[model samples]
Target chain A: MFECLFEQASLLKKICEAIKELTDQACFEVSGTGISLQAMDSSHVSLVSFLLRNEHFSQFRCDRNLTLGLNLKMITKILKTAGNEDRVTLRAEDDGDHLVMVIESKTGNKISSYEVKMLDIDQQAFGVNETDYKASTKMSSEEFQRICHDLLVVGDTVSIEMTKDGITFSVSGTETSGCITCRQSGTVDDESVGTEITLQEPMNLSFALKFLNLFTKATPLSNSVSIEMSADQPLCIHYDIGDMGNIRYFLAPKIDDEEGAGAAGAPAAAPTEAAGGDDE
Target chain B: MGIKHLMQVILENAPDAVVENPVPSYFGRVIGIDASMALYQFLIAVRVEGQQLTNDKGEVTSHLMGMFTRTTKMMAAGLRPVYVFDGRPPEAKQNELARRHEVREDAKEKEAEAKEAGDQAEMERFSRRQVRVNQQHCDEAKRLLTLMGIPYIEAPGEAEAQCAALCRAGKIWATGSEDMDSLCFGSPILLRNLTFSEARKLPIREVHLDQVIAGLGLTMPQFVDFCILCGCDYCGTIKGIGEKNALKLIKRWGTIEQALEHLDKTKFPLPESFNYQQARALFQQPEVLDPARVDLRWGQPDEEGLVQFLVGEKQFAEDRVRATTARLRASKQTATQSRLEQFMGPPAIMTSCSAPPGPWPMVQGPIVLTPSPFPPLRQQAGAAAAEKGNKKARTSAKGAKGAAKATATKPAAKKR
Candidate 1:
């Protein structure tokens, strides 16, 4: 049997929101360490990895390591029943086919229980090793989310260009163009509104804006976001889930249809050589 | 692509996704209907002599005949149908509309050609394709529904979308449409083939969106994506990715983009300018306005207005129109009795009549003073058994009047 309890219901709620945006069904691996999920989305354009340590919970117990294949949407629905001030308890037998969730009111007198059938999801784990990311940027997640949303109306692809000066998110269409440039600042009046960038070399790539926007689902899990990228490699977005764990998203860059510059919205601040491919 | 492929995909992916041939329990329930689709089907199937049914002024009466009979049947079966009419078409649907127009035009040309060649079968087939539900058709249908005491709503967009919205809002029990698109529009319950003849032994399919989601082990969004992969009118699909392939890919990959990546690019080449995003958005958040504000009133049928509009203007057969109205009245009465039985208890047998005594009652000899055991008091009780019994009592009264002559001399002695 496995059981875990949370003092605040919002932690699990945030985790569900972060996972459901990427995939509908996921295999959750539970161990003495905690709960962790790593799976590439069906489309293979993005990958979402989530981890929550056992110590983070108010109470945690596990008899053996188990893999629970769950329909994220169903569990998400169950989680939705929990109020912010409510205490949530998750329970499952070692060989049980269903997961039981009990939500209690602040007074602990009223409680509601939901039992969801679990699935036998055939999972093939895809692991990633540490990579040497050429450039990394730490910015307010809300700012990053807004930039992605605004650029979505302009075009389908966003060109992310990082330099010693700053990082720019740009998109261009036939009738409109949008770009948001954030530079590292030593001091700012508002603590939350700031960007810090560290670059080894200038790197540029184009990625689908929709996927980027989806990555913002992790925003509620963290106040600030860290972005690490390398040329010709997938972009990694990291979110720290307070004491619980961290959620990371890796999005692959769009390659070689030769329409990058036009679809990326002019790339106004890019060096002249970056526009050479489109000219031919 | 049509949603037919989506159904096929569901069959292949989750063979038990749809539970077919199930009876719908529509008792005391309200069903929202796609009125335009119904009218189109009626016009196509109810044709006589391979020609559309028209009145004296050459106005189409087919919609009227079908709706009148169908609505009456629904009412008799205890299902309240609220016909929803389509308003302006969405901009995304312009291409589909244009394509339909082209097909209709071609069918018209073929119909004329077949007529010239004296091919009856070809002409009939082509003629069915030429049936169009125009503004006049919709207006006349609404009028007929109004006259039949059925409620209808003029939707601002696709009638199915509005019907789905009504279903979601709990204003109606289910949405009645021929297509599965209502499921994509997020209708909680969708009833298919509602217009089919009720005599068929096979039960109508009632689809619950949640059950479908559970059966397929997919979220609502994933199902919508699967439908798009199978192809939809709003966007193009990758070539060579048919129903089975699309379902398998989605099951394996979990999204269209991932499915595309796993697919053999050489075989299934993605289309240029493919905009699944817009399609997904449309299915996720369709442009359906709030349905609660619409006043849904089932008013009394305007008998005189119906006769004027259907008989006077449209030239429907006068006798048939009158017969329909009479039948409607009879059915309404029966329906009310059934409703009363359900809510309260079965009505008690009554020996009283509300009809006032005629002037000849005094001359007929004290028959009006004693209450008659027969219930019918007017010629309006066509089907009431009490009326038949009352007729016998009236016939026997004539004999009693003759007998009164002999008893008249002793009337002063028989006063007590």
Candidate 2:
């Protein structure tokens, strides 16, 4: 048997909403350590993995490890029905066919329960070990979301270049071209509230802008987002969910086709030095 | 034709067995369509007065019109539909075919009577009932599918059974048809209200076989017996037993043999020639094309080829054909950006092979679902074999370019 409770419904609601943008169904690996999920999108171009520690929940209990395969869309829809102030508890048996969810109003005057069938989603976890990234940038979540959203209109991809000066994001289309460069600034607070940048061995990579926009769906869950890029591994987008835990999205770089190769070189046009300040 | 009232019975008994999706919800999905059933519906529905739509040569074009519009519309909406046409009828199905032949003969007589009486509406209704999907229609559909750059499979027996087998094999996400037999044949997912969506305002209903089995409190074998008892197209049903009684009896007795022993033969007599056992066996294991041998790819719709076939050969309106072909080509440019939407909207997009493949190990589930993610990248279990061919051929540019690609790809391959 396994059960866990969130003090409030909105946190659970946001997490579900954010992850549903990545996958329709996923395995929530529940263990005594905490609840973690590791799943890639259908294309295998990007993966979303996260762990919400056991201490974060109001009440958490599990006798044995359980892999709860669930339809994230269905879970999101069910969570939408709950009042934001309501307390939500999820309970499931080891060999049972469904997950039982109980939602109670903060006043305790009303309570509703839902039973969603479990899916047999056998997902193979791609071990995503933390890397000594060539470049890591922390920026305001809203700012990153804007850059991704706006650049998509110019082209399908964004060429990101991190140099000794700063981190530059630029795109070049057949008819239009645009660029935004973010420079190192105020300490990216350990609490993860401020903008900052750290570059070691400058790197440049082209990534699908649409995926970047999708990773920003987690913006509501946190005020800031950190991007880690390495030549050998998938780029990681991290969103710390307050003090509880953090969710990271790993996107594979676009293996440059002829067009992408041109765009990757065009980013050199962005302003050099990119003086200190938030683009937002 | 499907088992009578089986859908209704499932709807009533299994509370949450089927999930209702908004029309046009599936994007980048590969669904298997029972071809003949769709064409038959088109013959019956797309009509002007009592006459079938035809070309200048007086050859019927109703099925072609339906196939072009439906397939292109599905493609434009990001659904990769693979048509499955029936081949030879099975021995057990001979009885059902004979019954249908008799019905069509009666309809032809009624249609003649209506024509003689100058009753246009009655004549149309009777004529529609007499419609049949022959080898000509099947050939035309396969030809049109080829022209549109879609894959089609020729089943050895029933299309519904073949579709169910394909779904079970994870070749497609679901078996799409108006037939409930796909459920009895054990398709993991059956999608209804798929075709003629503009007219069908109701949401698409997806029936999960596993969910139905669990909800009905019956094992798969028990479900097959229940379906046979409920009345299958392959055999005669019990005289007084219908869907309701069959469900209750199956739930009570657990098997058809046991139900026959407990049933009152005096009040509820048996059919003239009954063979529940044989019908159950047919439903349990029907012949189908081996899923592994089937190569599914959503190639960019051959635009020029499509125009030549539809406009130059078939006498389709040039402008309409051109406009629809434009829609098909447009989907190629924006055919799923290979990242986020696959998990959100649809699970897969069969390798379209235009963009460079990503650097990731083809980590597979036990059953790899086709329409299997990434439009341009060759990223599926079947495509992995195809990729292996390219890996061996070393297709990169010669000299420095080839060497660079090898060095770039080697680490990724080793990491996986």
Candidate 3:
């Protein structure tokens, strides 16, 4: 009645690390097909959308489809206490309200279990439309995470400009502005340029670096992650969830001072000109 | 008797009545004292203790000691103390913070000037008599409040005003303050003499909004007039007129305009334009103190964990902490037990058996999660095929080539 197994515990730990940045609490909606979680941080700057399909788990069993709202910090604590070689097993006892997470080490050591409360969260479905993004590119998760971390030192906000050639991550402060661009000419060794879609419309969106860093922490789960951006719209980052499913994050762009004041004096910088330029 | 002796005689005779006479039940419960201000008073009291108040190290130590004592006493009282810390003040209060800052700066300058002038006595006096509250101390107070399990609200502006709002709204029974402005701000109950004695012994003066207006011999509008004439927050008042004169003027005239008409324009002058209406609105408009809706659940206390954190980590005195914790534990047993019971319930059964172990582990089996399962992409593709039926046929040929690459890479990528 209380035994379930997973090949690796590290994957869950990585996932927890990713979402822990966005929000302190999230509801994991598990159904017959897969598990999905959609939650926005308190600031509404970022949202963590995670999906793990049924095929990912080696032996998944359930009496019914259930939703467990978990505290991110508690889950991260349990995961941190676990060894990497340990096989993850989660079990339910005492009427599905409590969770026991066990990690069995390779040396035949007794599995250590941590009992956590499954809180009843007020789940409200947010109506978010799936928009057709202007451009999409895949880059290494490590690179993305590193870029976000470095950019945070400069400022709290980052402006992401994507075009036909590649992606440009820019941050501007009162004194200085920094930009990192990956174009067709200067392609990194491990990175892949799938397809270049021309920017019929150039969009410059600002987002909080804190949320970006948190959501990108899921990068270790996949070698490469895909990013899709549309001007004046939410940026969607897709993480390939091995054979299980995919985790897609939709982040609402911050309203910068220029764009918010009715676009009157804001420069219409040709997104094509800055598409692959190193100049900030 | 001499003035000091007469003051002592009066203090002995009165001894400050601890509990005021009980009034109507409409007055709210559990008054909130501005903890930061209370801490300031406690620190001053400590400085006054044992005739030794001149040392900087002594001042800091005394403040810290007072903090612990106040925390312990508040915990033993059984009153849910909601301490409110001031955040960024509103633009209106910028002047106040700046004014205080300027005064502190001037005091520092004066101390320096006195030192340079070889006025050692004045310099020592100024150093010892410094009354400025430090941000570090305020932060420490907040840390202490958190440890003590006293719920605190970070006020966007003035702590006293927020406390007053809380009182008027019936969120709290009264505001524990020496400042009479709370009454002007329409706080239903204002408890004085809290510092002088224990809460049980202290008299809480429950001042009703209607009674205040009636007792002051003015309508709600004219009562605000009396306060403004007696010096409201927004601006300075007439120099000569005291509270008694302002009250008499307001009662006779029935309005500030009427009072102004009777005043000597040259000596008892008024500002160019008085915003008495806004002031009236602030003081007269009763705050919605929705008591029933406040989430009072303090959650389960990890007593052992708290003990380990405070005593072991922070190096707080064990016996003193143990005593305070014992009292808190006794009072909080029911809530804590219920929370613990809830947390110890049944576990979660993983739904997807065949799902790969990843971030979003899916449930095994051929299950279509979405109700309309042409799949969103398939539906869009079908619609695109229908719309660009002819032109996309050639594009589809190129798409097939891309699809071939995707198919080839999918399996190998999954292996890693």
Candidate 4:
């Protein structure tokens, strides 16, 4: 049995907020350590991994470690229905196929239990290897988040480039493609920051800005956000979740025009959306 | 202008004129002007005669007159100005610049088209009212700075940031600009009123760079975060978040990271990967060091040349120009005499300008000054002269390649 209560229901809102970026469905494995979910986003550009440590829970009980696969949309709906004073309980039923989530309050009580189904998702076995990246920057989560919001109007894909001088965030497209770029020249104040990590390799990578925009939602949890990447390697974005735990999102670089489809190792339609979404 | 008259003019020409607090001192230093937004204010304040000024060749001279007058006034105030001539903008900003360029180009094109279409009246109106700063105007400003003995630094990228850096390094006291971004770049002073009379009347306000962050209830890092949130040249800020909301959110969250986390979970609309930290670092970084240093000195004034340029060429009122020149010459004389006394002092021989002397006896005269009070000048003068002659030899001896040879012989010479 796992139960948590907050005067404000927004705490649970954040947990679901991060998951929605990675995949529509998530399988959370609850153990003595707490709840953990690891999955790649739909575009496969990034992997989202989350862990809520046992110590952060108000009340935690687990007889054995159990993996529960649940749909993100369903969980979001349940969280949306939750009232500020409602007590939320999440428990795995005796029956292996079901999980029970109950929200109770003076107004009424709502009990919802979802059937667990094993999804045959073809997981890519990508190794995480460290590389020498030219520059690393720490930004306020709010600022980073704001950039992502702006990108929604600019384009779906954003490119990040890091040189010896500084890091740049840009987007480009043809008559069919538009781009935005942000560059920081190496200056004195940035050099004095002990937290910066810079190597010798200039890196350029493109990824769907939408995922980044959603991934940055976790920024409010910490003051500093760290980004690590290499020229042809996957970019790693790490968020500090305080005592609760950390959430890491790793994104694979998109293929360039010259490299063609061979680099991606899979043939698929290029991701482009019609301009129908609300500006906000 | 009287308030009633000003209000009437504003009501009639509201679209053409804008009024705001005078530019701050730090921003003024960056734009290389003592008066913040002075040129723009001047353009708005003075009413131009409908009759156009013409050269001997009968070419329109209004633009040149306006540019030259504004640039000369800026130079006399000791502001170093770099006039940026517009070029083909980078692809990213091209859309925005092109949009503006189109408006100007369209007016020109429309006038020509109107004349072709036999609408002579429309063509005449467009020709009469058009105002612009062209490449020729930029070149003229540069030439004027060169002749006036004021330094002009050409910008490789954004002219405003380069100008701000000049002020930041104390190369200049302030920048004169109409844009508010100078505040974001941490300029120490800005001045808004630029005309000769207005500038003299209004005292320039010095903006403590750090105070902006403090006033906004943020740290230096958070301030950068706040600016990024407010929107920047490189990127646009989130919707529904203006300057006030941006500051409030940053203050509440303390840092960009915390803000992102809170935003991520909260029902409040938030953008992903906002990276406020990165954006802050970009604008808040310290200004680059200037390779060329400032050497403040006192020298003879070219009174005849200055008088000819200001009175004969520019047609300025002679008395006003003479009064300003007199003040400049007096200040220059006081500075020179003080330096001469320092040169006579013994301590001055040992110390470079980097290390200034401690408090010395104040010399009270028509002009208050500090005398060079060093006592060892006569004794050290001869040795210092000889040392100066062998300066190159001494430096070569201390070179890295010579270190091994010197160290190798030390012990052998000791044993002997």
Write one digit per residue (lDDT tens) for candidate 2, span B1-416: 67778788777878577878765557656899999888988887776765888887888888888888978888776677888878778888889999999999999999999989999889888888899999778777776776676667778788899888888788898999999899999999899878763666777888988878887889999988888888888889888899889889999999998999999999999988898877887898788777766656555555677677777767889999988888775654442433333223323211111112333223334222233222111112113324333222222212212222121121111110
Which regions of candidate 1 deviate over 4 angstroms?
A1-280, B10-25, B198-202, B330-416
Q: What DockQ results do all the predictions give, each relative to the true complex?
A: 0.00, 0.04, 0.02, 0.01
Q: Please report the candidate that would top lDDT against the real structure.
A: 2
Estimate the TM-score of every prediction: 0.47, 0.64, 0.42, 0.35
Task: Show model 2 residue runs off by greater than 4 Å.
Answer: A1-136, A154-223, A228-236, A240-280, B23-25, B47-52, B112-123, B199-202, B333-416
Over B1-416, each residue of candidate 4 has an lDDT whose tens digit, in order, gives 00112223222323222323332221222245422133333333333453455445554444334444544444344333444222232333443455556776778988898889988678766654344445544444434333333344444344445456667666655555544556566666544344434534654433444544544446666666666676654444566776666667788987667776776444456555444454455466523324144221212334565566545655546786566555543322211101111111111111111122222111223121122121112112223324444232222212222221121111110000
Q: How would you encode candidate 1's per-residue C-alpha lDDT over B245-269 as one tens digit per residue?
A: 6667778889887876677878767
Candidate-wise lDDT, in order = 0.67, 0.72, 0.55, 0.47
Native contacts recovered, each model: 0.00, 0.03, 0.00, 0.00
Report the Cα interface RMSD of each model, rounded to 1 decimal.
38.9, 23.9, 23.5, 36.5
Ranking by lDDT: 2, 1, 3, 4
Docking quality level of the chain pair in candidate 2 = incorrect
lDDT for each residue of candidate 4 in A1-280, tens digit (9 for 90 to 100): 3333333355666778777856787656454445555666533446676665554555555543344556777777777877756656676632244556666663555544433343322222122333444556665566677777776676656777776555567765323444434344233363332234465667776766767887887876666667777655567787777756667776655443321223233211111121121111
Tell me the tens digit of each residue's lDDT in model 1 across A173-265: 646878888988744766675788878888887777878898998898888898999875678898988855788887777554222223233
- The DockQ of predicted model 4 stands at 0.01
| Model 2 interface root-mean-square deviation | 23.9
Cα error, candidate 4, residue B180 (Å): 1.9
